[model samples]
Structures are given as C-alpha cells and as structure tokens.
Target chain A: MAEKRLMYGNHALVEGIIYAGCRFFAGYPITPQNEVPEYMSIRMNEVGGVFLQTESEIAAINMLFGAGAAGVRATTSSSSPGISLMQEGISYIAGADIPVLVINIVRGGPGLGNIAPAQSDYYQATKGGGHGDYFTITLAPNSAQELFEFPKLAFELAEKYRNPALILADGLLGQMMEPVEFTFEPIDPGKLPEKDYALTGCRGRPRRVVRSYDLRPGKLEELNWKRYKKYQEIIKNEQRYETFNDKDAGLIIIAYGTCARVASAAMKMARDKNLKVGLLRPITLWPFPKDKVAQLSERIKDFLVVEMNCGQMIDDVRMATQFRSRIHFLGRPGGGVPTPPEVLKKIEEIMGGGR
Target chain B: MTKEVIVAGFGGQGIVSSGIILAYAGMFEDRHVTFFPSYGAEMRGGTANCSVVISSSPVASPIVAEPDVLIIMNEPSLLRFEPRLKPNGLLLYNKTLIKSEPKRSDITIIPVPANAIAEELGQGRIANMVMLGVLAKKTGILQLATLKKAQRIRYKKASEEQLSLNDQALERGYSFL
Candidate 1:
C-alpha cells in the first residue's frame, strides 16, 4: 500500500527509526535537530521504547554504547558542534565494533555556526571524524520520503558490518515538510534475530567481552586489520548513487542531499535549453560512488560540483576521475543554499554558454 | 503545472499554518506539495514567512526564489518579498493591516480587508483563512472544501466554535470579491 502522509523531515526520521525496531534513543536538544529529540520524547514512549534527553552530546553517545552493546538498536542525533563533542565516543563505538545510528543534521560550521542548512561535514562524516582506522556507513537523503526510508537501511547496514552508520543530512531537509509514502512494514524488534556478540545476561552461554583495545603487543594491529577487511568488503559491495540524463551528455553535475535537488532543477533548466547536461547524485557518501564516476568519465568529461559549503566533496570527485579533472564548483558557505538559476548559470558557463 | 507561493506576516499571524493548509489540500487533490518555513531568530515575535509549492510533477527545490503568488499579511513583508514575484504574478495583500499599495503594474494586485472581515467574523487571527479564500477563487490551485478539511488537521485543538469561525471567514472572503 502507498501509505503516504505529510510530515516534517525530522519527525520522519524518528518514525523511520521506530519502524526499524529501534528501542532506544538518546539525544540532546540542538537547533535544526531539536525536533528529532523532541518528537522522540513522545513517540518512543508510545512505542514502548526509551528516550533520554541527555545532559550533553557526550552523555548521549555513551548511553547509546550501553544500549548498543546490549544488542539493542540505539541512536542519537545532534548538530555540528554537538557531533564534534561526540567524536571520542564515536571512536570508542568504532573501536568496540558496535552497530549504532548517529545522525548529524548539519549546519554551517567550523565553529559555532548559525542554524541554517549546510553540507560542511562531508569530510567529517565520511573520513571518520573520530580518531581511528575505521569508517562508518554514510547515507545522504534528499527528500522527506528518503528520510523516512533511510533509517531502516542504515540500521541494516550498520548491523551487517557491526559498525556505526551516519545519516549526513542538513537543516533544510530537517525543517521542510512534504508527503512521504511509507514503503516497508514496521519491523518488530521482538521477533528479530539475536546478536551473537551481545553482552546480554550470560545465563546459559559463556560470558562475552566487547572492547576496542587489545593492548597485548600486536593484538590491536590484528583487530584493526580485521576491521579493515570489513571496510574493504563494504567498499567492494556498497556504493549508491543516482543518475539523470547522463547518456549522450558532455557535462554532469555531481552533488548530494539538498544540493542535489538544486542541481536537478538546474539540470532540467539546462535540458530545456537543449544542453547536453546530466546529474550524478551520490546517496552514500562513504564508498563514495567512485566507480560510477570513473565509468561515467569514459563517456562524459565536464562535471559541476555544487554544495552548501566552500568545497569538501569536490576532493572525492577529483580523486574519482584522477587527472581527467574538469570539475567546477559552486558553493554557499555559512548555511546559504545555491539557487537553480545560479547553478544553471554555472552549468551554462561550463558548457561554453551552450552545448 | 507548478505554483510557488510565499506567505508573509508577523509571527503571531498564521503565515506558516496558512502555507501548511494549502499544501495539505494540494496533497488531498493528488498534487505534489511542499511547505517550508523560514525559521530563524527573526521569527521570535518578528517578521515571518514561508514557501509553499504545489506541483503536478515532483517538486525540485524547497526554496522559492521567485513566487507565482505573493500573499502579504503585514506592511513589512510587502516590500521584502514583492520584488521576487514572477512577472504578471498575483500580489494579494491584507488591506486592513497594510497601508502601502503594491506599485507593480505588470502583476495583478488585490487588496483584501482580511483583518476587518475576520473581525466581523470574531477573530483577526483567522484573516489568513480569508486570504486563502481569495487565492483559491483566483488561481484555481486548491478548493475551499478541501481547505476546510485540511484546517481541521492543522487546528486539531480548535474548538467547534473556532473551527466554525474559520469556515465563515473563508466563505466570506471566497465570495467577497
């Protein structure tokens, strides 16, 4: 059934988490993302789950450690500075190989940035903000429907790799309201399979230990290598991106999240002018969708990278193409969004004013 | 067909809620709709505005750089947003609250005495419903019947009397032209 309803992006994320069988949510109140914790306060209780308004972002992530270590699907959300404070805890979670969901409703940043939408944290979320030789599965959603659907996918991916998953969204997507069609049945956490590594009561089984450090000699190296193999497998298996009007095109626009929506509008404008312009939107920030870009480079040459930041994801696109680099960037730092007309102008300039 | 509308006024006025009601009604009629509020520190007892998009196709960007229709509920918002109105667009302002007239000659300008009409029906807060009624009768974007149903969802806590007051305000503005 096409079960559609109008809801805010943050509220959709909460419902997505609850529907994915997440029984525990811990978060602190922050602008653009306050709705996540605020809605959780009520919906978690209604779903017989636990919602904690923690004193700080640090406490929230550590609380998630306790719940996640016990084999419960636990999560926490915050904005830029708050995400920064959770770095140590995230490193701890990564070190212990825990499956947890962390959401960053990103805002303009570097310091105490204003509460407007920005994608400045692309490097932070994808390259592992916390100190470790570890990577989290990162998913970027562009619409309210995708916001509603990505949580379940993130949870499954996190559990599959026994790693953390980050949903890198922005304030614009969080604050906007749109109709969302629920696609999946609500998952029942009760009937789910038991996690073999959980520190649940050691009633009949041997006591299990979960820790990030193996302090004995080369033991830490061995554990790091093991996680490396998992990352390699993930890199080989998981790379998600979207393409529009890519065939027989000379230029393509690469963006993600809110930026991609604007790029799409610009691409439509280009197409209306009969320009051979296309769009490539990466859904998964990690694993980077490099292979697709590399393949598309064989046919398409010029690429425009639009973002709400000065330029972060542009590095990934450059590395993906490797010296065939005809990449142009349009960015609006400090929480401003680039409009379709401005983006179209860039596309036209890159296209020599026409195809 | 796609229609982008911006509703602007002071904080207490139902500017954001009016956008939501329009979007909600658009959804009921099988149209793709998006409502985005301009949320900032400026919204605290200050000027507030919101963007609403109703489209036959999927909506692209939630931000409205150019609006097909501009609904001004206060004096400050008229000059702030009037320049962004599309050529030959509709400029609908509340005559009761706004003293300045739109100077655009290309666009169709309508000044509705929304506050006065709403006061005649009891509350000045429901003047947004009056503006919505004018928008409905002019553009054919949404229906008054569907909007009434959508308001019940938006004002779920409103008493029967308040709801009836809103319906009358809409009815009065719908035929007031």
Candidate 2:
C-alpha cells in the first residue's frame, strides 16, 4: 500500500530526491522554490546527507558539478533568473558527461520578471540554454504526485545517459499542497556504481579527470559526436507523454506543466457542452513527443497550445504539425495563470473555426 | 461528489490554516484534495485567501473560480468573494466582523459570530477554529470527529492546553448555529 502524505510540491520533490539516493543538495534560496532547500536543510541531516546553502546560484551549480563528478547523487534547484546564472555550469556538466539533477521551479522572466509561475523557460530548458550541442532530459510534472515520482526517474535517466536531467516545475505546483502517495522505495546509495569512474583517491587505478574542455581540435570534435550520438539514442527511446480524450476527438490541445491541468479542466468543460476537445500533455519537454503529435494530426482537425508564457511551446506544436494543421496559442505572461474558463473560451473559439 | 471551497480573510486571521485543515480532513478520508494559497508579494495584514478542493476522483484544476462554499472572515473578503460564489452555494461569514447583509438570496447564508465566541473563549485567534467548526457542521464536508483528528495533527507541536482551547473553540462554534 502506498503511504499517503500531504506535502507541498517543493517539499515532495525533496522527498523524491531523497528516495532516489540523492545525498548532496547545494542550492541558493529563491522564491517559489525556497521550500525545497528549507525542507532539505531540515531533512538531510536525518538521512546523513549534505545540504549546502550556497551564496549564489553560480556557486551552487558548480558545487553540484563537483559533487556529481565525485560520483554522488547530487542536485541543485532555483528559479528563472537563477537558472540563467547556472547555464554555463550546466553546459559544462553535460559536456563532461556527469550525472546531476537541475531543478528549475520556474517563475516569470526575461530578467527578474516576478515571483509568479510561468513556463517562459521552455526554450531555455529544452533547447540547450547554454553554449552546447547537448540536451538535458527535461521532465515536466503537473501535480504534487508527479512531482514526487519524477525525481527518481530523473536520477535514473541521468545516470543511465551519463548526463544532466531537469525537473521543470512552476511556482503554482511548487507552493501548492496536495496529498501524494509516494510510489518509489528508498535505495541504498552505497550499492550503486557511482564509484566506478569516480575520482575517489585513485591509489592503484588510473586517475580519472572529469572535465568538459578539450584543447585539441580533432579530439573535441570526436567527443562532441559521441555526445550527440548518445543524445540521439535518448531522443529515440525516452519520449513520454499522455493523451486525454483525443482518440476520437477533432481538436487537440497541446500543453505541459501546470498549464496542462488547466487545459485538462477546459477539455472537461468543453466535453460537457458537446465540444469534442481533448488534451495532449507532454511529460517530457526536451524530447518534445513530436511523433505523438504527428500521429494525432491525422485525426485531429486543429490544435491549441496553452502555456503560462507567451507562445513558447506553441512553436513546438506548430513544428510537430509541420504547419499543416491550424495551431493556436493562449498564454498569460509576467504572472497570472490561465484559468479553465479562459481556456474553454479559446477552445470554443477554435471549435467554431474548425467546424 | 466534489466540493470547492474558498476561505478568505485578513492575513493573520488563519484563513490559510483553515483551508489546510479542511483539505487534510478530506485527504485523511481517502479523498483527493488540493490547497492553493494566494501567494507572491502578499504581506501580513493584507488580504489573504486560499482555495481548497476535495473530490472522490482526481481534482483537475486547483483554481476555484466559483466556489461551492465561501467562508468570509472579514469585510474585504466578503466583498471580494461574494460575487464569485456559485448559485445555491453555502455562504458562511463572521457576523461579528461583517455588518452588512448579504445581497444574494439564492445561496444559503449561515451567520456565525465567531469573533465574539472566540473572545468569550478568552482567545481571539481561535475565531478561525470556531468558523471551521461551523463549517464542519453546516456543510457536512467534514465530520466533527474528522475535524478533531485534523486539529490534533495540526497542533501536535502545541501545548496540551492550547489544543484543548482550540477544541473548545471548535465545539463552541459548531453549536453556534
């Protein structure tokens, strides 16, 4: 039987990491995500883990990079501007093939927008925020239960691919409280193969240097190609999404994160009014789930993309449909989230045009 | 059945805590529950509110636009949330703090003098608990036993006397109507 516990989404993510055998947490305090570090600070000691409150986001990511390089399950979390600060370090970690968890409890921003939830980081998170030819596996969770389950999945994927993984949650999900049944069991951190290539005081074995830099030109190209090959393998195998009421529907709404919940509610309202609207929620943002979108295009007449940011994921929806189907966008940036009624209005407008 | 509730009041009036207790009671009974606080740039002594939803099935939206039950702890909360309550909804307010009569006739309004009752109990802060008791009795969303369980869990860290005071406040408020 699953243990039922009521927790904030941010706190749930911390519990997920702990269950995933994450023993090191280094992060700076930021709004909407402060609960994560606050919980970790209190709970890490009980589990004999290390929790560091870094002076800056830059310092925190680097600390995560160091801990990850030393082969410990480590993570760091921040909001939009703080995520921006850690871009270079994220690129370096990916290039070095180190497994780390980067959590962005996203708030609105081009630069310091506000402390409200927004999906504005879609591009920055999925399209490689830093200077790199690499992609981090980005998981988007809509509720507190998913928030509890995704971190363990993130860590497993990160370790399997030898790359970084991101949990892209928003302020609403982070701050809200809900009852979540934890599904994953705790694992012993000592039993994992984290020490195989780790720089653990190499006495008899060869010293392993974990780094992203290659001074020679040809060698760097070879490394980049190898990384790209692995990323391609990830793209082929790791796409995850959920389709709601769309198998026989005419119109599909593409949404992710907290916006997906609102879109789901809107779809329910539309169905009540005899409008055949459905929802396609992307659980993984980086892999994009393009194949699923393309398949749905055969039956669906049009698509509506809802987001907290102005038209970020809509571009991906258009790309997936190849600009063949009518794709529309409904967004609210700089703070507020779209409600079900607002999404229902947009759905009705699209249904009017589609018919 | 699904129930959407909005509890609104001044920041220190325990509006958010009442929502938490309600949601906790729902969850303890094996129902899906969500509690969303109005946050960000919100300061103490300002308007504060939270939305709580409880359902047998999964809750689709945490945002409650038209609540089935609206609890107003102050005048500003009354003005702000009165128009948003659904038709034939349950409207519960603190009659001691709110002087004006409700304008709508379709909804069932329960007037509980929670502040006066809490004052009589020798602690003004327990007014929210009194309101919670009335809510438990009037709506049947939570049973008196479930409310007591929730109160025990919520104040597990408090002294025994404090817990008893809250229980007294709750019993007083539940019978107020």
TM-score of each: 0.98, 0.97
Per-candidate count of clashing residue pairs (backbone under 3 Å): 0, 0
User: Please, what are the lDDT tens digits per residue for candidate 1 over residues B76-147?
Assistant: 999899998999999999999899889889899999999999998878899999999999999989998998
A88-203 in candidate 1: lDDT tens per residue?
99999999999999999999898999999999998999998999898989999999999899999999999999999999999999999999998889999998789999999999
Q: Predicted candidate 2: interface RMSD?
A: 0.7
What is the CAPRI rating of model 1's predicted complex? Answer: medium
Best by TM-score: 1
- Which prediction has the highest DockQ against the true structure? 2
Off by over 4 Å in 2: A353-355
Q: Rate the local accuracy (lDDT) of all candidates.
A: 0.92, 0.90
Q: What is the fraction of true interface contacts found in candidate 2? A: 0.68
